[model samples]
Target: MIDAQTLEAPTENPTIRTSRRWSPGACVWCGGTESVEEYRNEPRCATCRHHESVIEEARRFMGMYGLRPIGGTLQSDDDEEYEHRLGARDSRRVLNEIRLEHQPDPELVRKALRPRAAAVVAEGKPAAKRPSTASSATGSSRTASASAKTAAPVKTGTVDIDEIQTRALALLDQLTAIDAQLSLVADQSGLAARARRSDLEKQKATVLRTLAALEKARLSAASK
Candidate 1:
C-alpha cells in the first residue's frame, strides 16, 4: 500500500512555488519546463492563460462602465467581447472637448493650423523697399500685425481652486455616506464578511480632503 504520509502530502499550487525540479517538456505559454525557467519567464498552460484573458476582459468591461480604474490598476479596455459605455472620466474629457467650440482660441492649436499666419505681416511687400519706409509706418499694417500677435486667442485653461474645493467637498460627503453604509453592511453574515465598504469610504474621504488642502495651498500661491 502507498505510504500514508505520501498520500497525505499536498499537491502544489500553480501560483505558489515549492520545488526545484525541472519537467522534461516545455510549458505551452512561455516554453519553460524548469521551475527556475518558469519563474523567470512566467510560463503557463493555455487554459490558465485563457482564464487570465477572461479576467482581463471582465476588468475592462467594469472600467468602461465607470468603475474607477479598479483599486490600483488602470484597466485597458481593448477586448472586443466586452464592450461597455464610457466612464465618468472619459465623459468629462468628451464634454471638455465639446466646450472648445465655444472658445476655440488655444494659441498652440491656432499656430499649428495656420502656419502661414506666423509670417511677418510685411512678407507680401515688394523685394525693394523705399528708403524712408518704416515697417510699422502704415495704419493698416500696424493693425494687422498687432492683431496677429495679440488676438490669435484668449482661451482660459486655468484650474479653478474654488471649484476644485467644491468637488472635493462633494466627494468627501459621498465617502462619508459610503462609510456609514459599509459599517451597516460589514456585520452581515456570509459573503458580506469580505466587504470593506466602510474602510474604503473612510479612506476616500481622507484622501480627498488631504488633496484638497494641498491643492488649495498650491493654487493660493500660484494665483498670487
Candidate 2:
C-alpha cells in the first residue's frame, strides 16, 4: 500500500498514520514491500521509508559529533546525508548481516551499531582514513604566526617574582591576623563569664535581704 502521511513529533498521535490499508508491492530502493517502515499499522514501503529515515539519522550523527549544520545542510545528490544515510542508518544491521562470518571487537561492534558515517565523522576522520595531524600541526604554526602578526605587540612589562612572593607572604600574614583576633575574643569571653558570676552574686544578696525583711515583718505582726 502506497499512502502519504504527515509524520508527527517522535511520540505524538500521528495526524495521518491510518490513511492506508496494508498491501504489498515491489520496494523502489530495495525490493521487499512486505515489511513495515515506520511502525506497525504505518504506511510506506520499508525501502522508501528507510531512505527518509537515513536522512534523519545522518542529522543525529552530525549532532552527536558536535557538527552543527550551518544555516542548513548542503543540497546535493552526492551529499553524505543523502547517500550513506541508509548504510549509516543502522550499522548494527550491517554488522548483523555479516556478523556470522566475523565477530568484531566489542568497541568496534558498538561503533558498528552507531550511524556509520556519523561515527566516522565524529571520530574526526573520514571512513577511509585517520585524521592527519601532520597537516593540522603544520597549519597550527601558520595560524600561530598569523595570529601573532594580527595581535597587538606585547608591552615589555617585566614581572617581578620577588613582588609576587611578597604579596603571597602578605596573604599569609593576613591569615595569621585572625590569631590575634581569636586571642582577644578569648580574653573578652573570660571577662564576660566573670561579670556574669558577679551579677549572680549581687542578685543572691538582694534575695537574702528580702527574706530577712519578710521574717522581721512577721515578728512585728505577731507582737501586734
Candidate 3:
C-alpha cells in the first residue's frame, strides 16, 4: 500500500481535478487539509493559492517577453544561451514578485540588448518576395537605385489595422523582455541601472496603451 503521506492527496472539492483518482493526501508545503490543489507541477493545498498566483503571473510575464521555461527556470528562445541567463536570486524574484523574498541586487547583464525595429507594411499581404537581381553588378546596382527612388512611400492612413496590430504584438514581446531585465537591475547602486529602469517604465506604459488601443480597434472593426 502506498503511504498517503508520500503521495499527493485530492482537494476537498474533488471535482476540481479531473485527471486522476482522488486520494486523501496532505500539502507538501503548508500541510493544509481543506482543499489541496496541483500547482507548478506539484501538489499544493488551498493555503498555497497565493503562491500559485505568483507563479501564474510569472509565466504570463515570461510569455509576454518571448521567454519559455528551459528546465525549471526561464530562458529566451534565442540561439545564444548566455544572452538571457538569469541568476538564482533573480530567478526566484521572477518566480514570485509579491513577497520579493531573497531578491538579488541589481546588476547589468554583460550582453546588453536593445529593441529591434519592426517594419509593418500597409494592406494586402506583404508583396511576395521578389527574385534577386541577376544582371551585371553595375547594372543591378543602378536598377536597385532607380527602383528605390521610384517606389512610393507607405502612408499611415493606408496601413493595415491587422498588420499593425501584429507588429505591435511582436514589439510588445521584445519590450516585455526588456522590462523583465530592468526589474532584475532596479534600485541597487548605479546611475545606469536607474536610467535604464526609468526608460523601460516609460516604454512599457506606452506599449501597453498602444496594445489596448489596438485591441479596442480590432473589436470595434469586428463588431461593424
Candidate 4:
C-alpha cells in the first residue's frame, strides 16, 4: 500500500513546467491583458503585435525600394491615433505598393515627407474660453492676440519647391489608386463594399485637397 505522503506527492511534469515558465500574465509591449499571445517567447497584445508587424512590413518595403522611412506624423502611419483611424491600414498598404512600384528618388522622398505639424497646428483654432462680463475688453484683446499668433505665416524655410512638386505628383498617383478602389466598390451592394467605398472616397478627397495645397505651396515657394 502506498503511504498518504507518497500518494499526495506532486509530480514534476516537464511539459507543465515549460508551459508555466512561458505563460505571460500581461502584454510585454503595452501591458494590457486582452488577447495576449506569445511571440518569440515574449507576450504581446494583438494590437501591439499587429502594429509591430505593420511597421516591420513598412520598413522592409522602404528598404527594398531604397527609401528611408521618415519619422513624423505626416510621413508615418505608425502613430497610435492613426492606427485607430478608419482605413489607415489600407492607406499604408496602398502607399507601400505605390512606393515599391514607382521607386521614387530617395532624396525626393525624404524632402517631400518632412514634418508639417507646425502648419497643421497653425491652421487649427484654439479652444474657446468661458465668457466673462467682468473682463470683456481684456478677453477681446487676448483673443485678438491669440488670433494674430495663430494667423502668423507658417515658416517655409524647410519646404522645397521641387519637393512639393514631387509630393504632389506622388499624391496624384495615390489618388488614382483610391479612385480605382472606389470604382470597384461603386457597383457592389454589400455592406462591406459600401464601407470600403466610403473610406476610399474620403481618402480620395483628402488626397485631392492635399495635392491642391501642395501645388499652391509649390507655386508660393517658387515665387519666393
Candidate 5:
C-alpha cells in the first residue's frame, strides 16, 4: 500500500551491525580476560604486558653491548613472536652476565625479585669464602697423589676416557643448540639479528675448538 516514490530500501543501523565491539578487560596477547591493561592501545594481561615491556627494554639496552637494531616494524605475529623469544633469551644472558660480574648473593637477588618472600628466609647467614691459590694448589696435589696411590691404573684410564667422552658429548650438544639459534636468526634481517648471529658463530667456534681439544685428548689417552 506504500507509494513507490515514498518507499525506500531498509538500511542497516551501522552501530548495531558493526562487527567490531569494544571489549573491556580482554587481553589481545594471551586471550585472557583478567588483569588486563592497555599497552600501545591494545588490551593485554598483566603478565603479557610485563613481558612485552621487558622485551622492548632489552632491545633498547642492546646498544650497550655494541649491538644496534635496524629500525623496522614487525610485519606479522610470527615476526613479533620471534623477536619476543629472542629478547627474552638475550635478557636471560644479560642477567647471567650481570650476576657473574657483580657476584651478588643469590638470596639477595631472590629477595629483590620477590619482596614478599624476603620475610620467609632467615637473615645473617655467613657468605662462604673461596680458598686461596696456594691452598687450592696444595689440596689438588695431595688429592692427585692420593688418587694415584689408591686408584688402579686401568680404572684411572677408564675414568679419564669416560670424562673425556662426556665433555665431548656436552660440547656437541652445545654446538647443536648454537646452530639452531643461528638458523632462527638467519631469516631475520636486522642489526640485532646480525649481532646475535655473530655471537652464535663465536660460541660455535669456541665449542668446535673445545671439541677438537677433547678429541685430541681422547686420542692421546687411547694411545696411553
Candidate 6:
C-alpha cells in the first residue's frame, strides 16, 4: 500500500493546468517578434502602433466632416444625399490607401496637418474691404485719360497724289540707270563686282514694285 503523499507526487502528467502560457511568434502585420510584452494582447508590432493611431485619427476626421461610411448598401434618390455618400466613399478609399502605402512618421504627419490648419485660421480672419464699382470705374477712366495723354497723336491728312506720282517717276528713272549699270557689271569677273550688280538688281525690283503700288493707290484715290 502507497502513502497519500507518495500517490499524489508520483503522477507524470497533471490533468489540470495552473498557469497561462503564450506561444512566441512574428507579428501578422510587420513580421516582428520584438517588444513581446508591449504587443502581448494584440498580434501587431510596436512600430505599427503609431500607424494604427493615425488610422483612428483619420476616421475621426471623416466623422467630424459628416463623411463617415454607414452600414448597408447606399440607396439615395436625393442629389445632396448621393453627393454626401460619394464624398464619404472617396474619403474612405483615400484613407485606406494611405494606411496601406505609408509608414506613419510624426514629423511628416505634423507637416501635412499645417496647411489645413493655416487654411482654417485664414478662413476665420476678417476679409479685406473691396473697392466700390464707382471707384473702380473712376480709376479705369483716369488710366484711360493718362494713356490718351501719353500716346503719340495720329496725323490725319490727305495724301498728296501729285507729289507721290513725281517721286514714283524719279524712282523709275533711277531704276533704269541702275539696270544698265547692272548689265555692264554682269560680265566683270570679280566677287565685289558681282555683289554690286546683285544689289543694283534688288534696288531696281523694289523700285518697280513701289511704282506699281503708288500708281494703283493714286488711281483709287482719284476715283474716290
- By lDDT, who's the top model here? 5
Local distance difference test values of all predictions, in order: 0.36, 0.35, 0.40, 0.44, 0.45, 0.43
Off by over 4 Å in 5: 1-159
Residue pairs in collision within model 3: 9-25, 36-45
Tens-digit lDDT track for model 2 on 1-224?
A: 33222122112333322222222332211223446442211223454455434543554433322233312334423345444444443532422221112111224322333464354457685322222222322222234343221122111111223333444455455445544444445445577756755664555454454344334433433444
TM-score of each: 0.26, 0.19, 0.28, 0.33, 0.31, 0.31
Model 1 RMSD vs true structure: 25.8
Q: Flag regions of model 4 displaced more than 4 Å.
A: 1-154
How high is the lDDT of residue 127 in model 5? 27
| Candidate 1: C-alpha lDDT | 0.36
Q: Regarding TM-score, does 3 or 5 come out ahead?
A: 5
Clash-forming residue pairs, model 2: none
Worst 10 residues of 3 by lDDT: 108-117
Model 6: weakest 10-residue lDDT segment is: 148-157
Candidate 3 per-residue C-alpha lDDT over 1-224 given as tens digits, one digit per residue, 9 for 90 to 100: 32232244334433322233223353333334446654432334554455345433444333333334322544444323323334322433422222112111111110111111011223333343111111221221233344321122212222235655676778789787977887798756688878877888877876676566556555544454
Residue 133, model 2: lDDT of 28
Kindly list the per-residue Cα lDDT of model 5 for residues 32-63, writing each as its tens digit: 44576545434445655555466545443232
Cα distance off (Å), candidate 3, residue 11: 83
Measured by TM-score, the strongest candidate is: 4
Better of 1 and 6 by lDDT: 6
In TM-score terms, candidate 4 sits at 0.33
For model 6, residues 1-224, the per-residue Cα lDDT tens digits are: 22222223222433311111123343322333444222212334444444444433433332322332332345553454455555545544432322211122324333544565466557774332122322322332234333221122111112336656777789878988987898889889888997998888878887786677667656655665
lDDT ranking, best first = 5, 4, 6, 3, 1, 2
Query: Over 4 Å off in model 6, which ranges?
Result: 1-157
TM-score of 1: 0.26
Model 2 regions more than 4 Å off: 1-33, 37-41, 70-224
* CA-only RMSD, every prediction: 25.8, 33.4, 24.1, 22.6, 24.7, 34.2
